[model samples]
Target: AYDGGSPTRSSQMRLDIVILDINDHAPVFNQSRYQALISESLLPGASVLQVYATDADQGPNGDVRYEINRRQSDPEGYFTINAQSGLIQINKPLDYETRKVHELVVQAKDGAEQPEVGTAFVSIQVRDSNDNQPSMTIIFLSEDGAPRVSEGANPGQYVARISVSDP
Candidate 1:
């Protein structure tokens, strides 16, 4: 060996790196818009439907929570949603005569410090129920002013003019 100039040995090694995930993805609903048809007789606290969403990120960033957007027009407070389960339920009585259709905006947000949010539109159509009793108006056609059938009344004869209606 001629001092430091003689030779210099070299060593080579391989290195690997791992990249962790961040809260970069927002929750996405299975459907952007949903529709349901329910009867007006549906009672309070009854389950209406379920909404679902998913996040692509890992850990807490991927966790999704559900909510009914209060910013939307829900003046009747007719519906509620489960924060963790995304189950939509009826919060009040439904009346087809009062309002036949309801529109709601639901939100899904990720569990992040600065959460990302996704929105879905829900349309509920209330089917008419037999909630109202039929009203009747009768006008007697008999010779007597009172509501009575005469003994000599002919068969299939019109006894009274009846009108019925329901709202």
Candidate 2:
């Protein structure tokens, strides 16, 4: 290390050089965007996906904490984050029929005082689950609009209409 731009000539005099870390660099995510698909039948508190980031700063200044921007990004309140781990987890059940896509912003901030921050976008696609039971409606009638059955009836003698729907 040079003191005042001039190196002090010393051998056994013992000159200690220390480099300090400053919060000059902001945390940066490895990727600008991350996407994943999850089933709508997934329960709450399940881990869906994760995002990673890095900071050039040293020591505590490089340590990052993750968070979700609820007001502007996660308005539906469907997700959570591990502050120190950068893991994004689910907070509630998902419904693909009502809504298919969820967009949220993830923020990474350093542990330094007046910490530098960074952000990334996350897109979660909810896949429809075959959990809904089909609803069926049946109507039976004769050609003359009267219900009549015969043991010796010919083929195509009965008229029945069945309709089914599911979500």
Candidate 3:
């Protein structure tokens, strides 16, 4: 029997492969600071300011999610955000007495697991508007010159104390 041996001559094989980049880390914000102002006179629900961010990765890996991180100090959520759009809008009225400036931190995350996180600071300055009227604590002085006045005081009389609060 005759046997044919293999590999007597050298041969070559060709192959093609592509490797995609992994989005291990997300894009981070360079500056995590911001400030803004909205006059109390402005109509309620008015768009005050907008915040923006950037992503370093490509494709869906670069897609980011935006959200507002509320602190314990902020019982009331005074701001809103558009996740896809990265827009921040005011959600409540501001009272100077209660809060003159609002401090907030915005977070951005990429699609990757344990995605990279970025932060931004926002300071909102509230201006005074005629909308807030001051009311006196005392309703009115008695005609008999009595220190204590009875209930049902006149409109102009000192009825209650008025204060302003902002968020």
By TM-score, who's the top model here?
Answer: 2
- How does candidate 2 score on lDDT? 0.87
What is the per-residue lDDT of model 3 for residues 1-167, given as tens digits with 9 covering 90 to 100? 22346635555667788777578666676567777787765655677666666787776678888888776224487778788766777677667667778787788888776577778887888876666555544423456544654577666676344454432
Q: Candidate order by lDDT, highest to lowest?
A: 1, 2, 3
lDDT of 1 by residue, 127-151 (tens): 9989899999998986775699878
lDDT of each: 0.91, 0.87, 0.69
- Any runs in candidate 1 off by more than 4 Å, and if so which? 1-18, 138-162
Error of 1 at 44 (Å): 1.3
lDDT of 2 by residue, 53-139 (tens): 999999999998899988778777899889888788889888898889999999999989899989999999999999888999877
Total clashing pairs for each candidate: 0, 0, 8
Give the TM-score comparing model 3 with the true structure, all chains together.
0.67
Residue 104, model 2: lDDT of 91
TM-scores of all predicted structures: 0.76, 0.77, 0.67
Clashing pairs in 1: none
Q: What is the lDDT for 142 in model 3?
A: 51
Q: Which parts of model 2 have CA positions greater than 4 angstroms off? A: 1-13, 138-161
